[model samples]
Target: MYSLLQRLRSLRHGFWYGVSRRIRWSRGAFEEAPARELCNVDPEPAERIAALRDRYQVQFELGMSAATSRNNYEYLDLLDRGWSSLGIGRPSGGVLCDIGCASFWYAATLQAFFQPDRLLGVEVEGHRLFRDGRARIDYAAGYLWRLPNAEFVVADYTRCLLPADLITCWFAFLTPAAILAWRLPLSLLAPERLFPRIRHNLRPVGLFFMVNHGPAEAALAEGLCAAAGLRRAGRWSSPAALSRYRMLPSVLSWWRAG
Candidate 1:
């Protein structure tokens, strides 16, 4: 019943949050943003899973959301915001780091979509998610082998140092703070330290983009942004705009180097 209670709490949160943020929703926001492309990969899960196995020589599973992502325009829509929000016009071969990049899907997908100079996906699990840590790393490395420019590392961001021209964090709060509180609360409470690291590593005038799903989450993110001394670039609070990008009560905030 602990699980049931959790689900109930989640449902309640979604209901209240949706009602409170209803004013921001609009279909027009989606219409106004740049167009998005649908997923081009085969619809069959077996086919896709097989492809990963053959390429990486490991048995890996993709979350239902990410597996079906390409079939719809949602993923591309999110990427559209990532690109437009950061003001990345063309590929200048800049470095991009995705924090808490689990399963390496965002890192891999965005790498293919944006073709940046280099892409770094940092996760705490490393390769241990699979049979052993090596398999996971091998899977990530092998998957991006052709890309050559993209690399994956298993490490905690708060304890480690990482630099990038563009840094992104998406839906990280989905993971319960309790699970992360002991290991690295800074990532949850105050990621100000990461701000300086990004500033130090990012190219001139680099960008940091953060998305949080609800008011509560946005509050935490804002605190981190302030602690990091990040200058707000822009925000998308409109309901339609947030929904179009699959963000919840979402605050799409970006920061530029001061």
Candidate 2:
């Protein structure tokens, strides 16, 4: 009975996924507009912002909306903490790829923080259209059109061809429950195969940074990376809450390819 129910759910989700993909493809790409505003959230503390600037030597710009501004600050804070905790310095110039980047929402923040010579946001579902408040827009296209050095590709990360000096993956699905929660087909859950591909695409001594939802996910992710032969460089969990959301604390970990 359990197997039967799971099959039924997969069939239902697969049908919807096909339908959505066709609709998005039919719409084609829209003219790049101003990036959309994210959902409303409280702004980061002013003192925290000052601290991030001092530590990272980076500046923040006011976002198109209050929510966007707040999100920008949060991302910066997260990256600052993650890098510092890992004892890694900012990269001078190299290719950086962000895997499973839903909408590549934080492209600008990444560009500023890493200052990479090239930045790529790779997503399996690249054709997903998002309403950016003004109009329906293709997130990847909009970012590609606006950011000169950034590129967005629609492809499976496991098969990505470009080698990267730095890779960032935020909340990659590692369990069937997590995949189903996102309405993705269970077959897409492949952490066993995914970690090795991530390691394969990294240049020698490249850095792979990941953020897991909570302690459980972090443990699973760390184990998978270890099984794939990636060396753990550092791990950290923020002492103070960073976002207004009441979800579990995000755990940041970094690995190096030998």
Candidate 3:
């Protein structure tokens, strides 16, 4: 949806473009932002599930080692906005947090698309330029903690949301093969506990996306969701560009249950 040049320009100077007090806006955003908040994650069914990440590592995207992400609406948004970055977490309402949100490409995209609403992205590293004038996207750069106006928080797959409309995990899971390493080079030592956390974090029929890891990865992820009691809404596939680190070609999974 965006040419390379335009995307680059947007990235380099999106803050600049937004600097003018005369920033433009989409009429629908005011309506959509609030409505979307109603969809926050909940319903996976667990009263006391311990956190799964089990490790206090740096958030991936904002810096260098970010988790996987989509190349469709996300990529297209950045493409259109003229920026190149790690599109970390999902867009949720009501204290949203993209657990494991890396660079927060999605927040940037929302700023580009919606152009008005405030989006606070919590990461291990902060990245907000207030002078840019684009409603200063919040960057709670540090280990995840419950914060005000911070609807999201990055965590391990087994982590659950306090309460949110959406939870985006863009292929941020163990690989089929690497699933055996079980050390720092990997992610965590306890693999068995993670699935339960993923299941616990879901908001009943909340939405989560996975672009490509392979049929096996999809099936395993689906099974984990089912065990967590989340029903499958459907799966979708479409042509989109992926990050250099992205290995998937199409987003082949989706879910919703209430």
Candidate 4:
């Protein structure tokens, strides 16, 4: 009788285990969407894009968010044009660092455009709740594996210190709280909090590129620029031609260290 009862308990536990296995409760992982659907790519030499994709595996999605103008091929085009306008790659060879690089999409883009002497990316994984921490670790590692010229450090930007001739922040913001509460102001995010570290990390005459999600954040970025004692180089908003992108604020501002 005791043996029979023990077997019954074992069977019961196995059945529930099977049932639980069938039901997924975890938020799981970040889903990949087709890259073409997310962005408009101007006609470029096949070699260029092919090389980019091959190196970074940056198809399906551009960055952390696909919302509005946050993620797309047009963003890269805009960066290219903005860099050209700012004369960023002038006289050649310098280190380029991307803060909150996420998957290193922008880092790869900068490398291709500027051909920087060294490319470094700083990111803090599991910063968002949407994706699992393990997934983010894997993604960051994959980016480093594919881009031989690029190096990524998994550390929070607010504290991590890495030197660079150029540093860029693209849609990097504080995660909003519950719907009932307000979104954290941009002033409190890394751009402002890490200003001192950024100043220290940048080489003399180094540049910082900040792209805010909208006009409101642009105002905050301006304040950050002032707090850091950085001189404004130029500012550009989203172009009229990008109808979808225009919905977002899309302010691109450059600042130079003294």
Top-TM-score candidate index: 2
Cα lDDT for residue 97, candidate 2:
93
Question: Which segments of candidate 3 are over 4 A away from where they belong?
Answer: 1-95, 110-161, 176-184, 187-192, 241-247
RMSD in order of candidates = 13.8, 3.7, 18.1, 12.9
Ranking by lDDT: 2, 4, 1, 3
> What's the distance in Å from true for residue 19, model 1?
43
| Highest-scoring model, lDDT | 2
TM value for model 4 = 0.64
Clashing residue pairs for model 1: 24-239, 25-239, 25-240, 26-240, 39-70, 93-117, 127-133, 128-133
Clashes of 1: 8
Candidate 3 per-residue lDDT over residues 1-258, each given as its tens digit: 445654454454444433422442212101111121112223331110111111212122332212211222344432322221223333334323344455354543333332323344433212223443222223222221222233333333344444334444555454523422211122232335644554455565455444445566677767766765566655654433333344653345555543
lDDT of 1 at 83: 54
Worst 10 residues of 4 by lDDT: 177-186
lDDT minimum window of 10 residues, candidate 3: 45-54
lDDT of 1 at 41: 41
Report the lDDT of model 1 for residue 105. 48
The runs of at least 3 residues in candidate 4 whose Cα sits more than 4 Å from the true structure, single-residue gaps closed, are 1-72, 87-92, 126-134, 174-191, 240-246
Q: Which sections of candidate 1 miss by over 4 Å? A: 1-68, 71-73, 81-91, 130-135, 173-192, 238-249
TM-score, predicted candidate 1 vs. hidden true structure: 0.58
The Cα RMSD of model 3 versus the native structure comes to 18.1
Candidate 3 global CA lDDT score: 0.37
Q: In model 2, state the lDDT of residue 195.
A: 93
TM-score of each: 0.58, 0.83, 0.44, 0.64
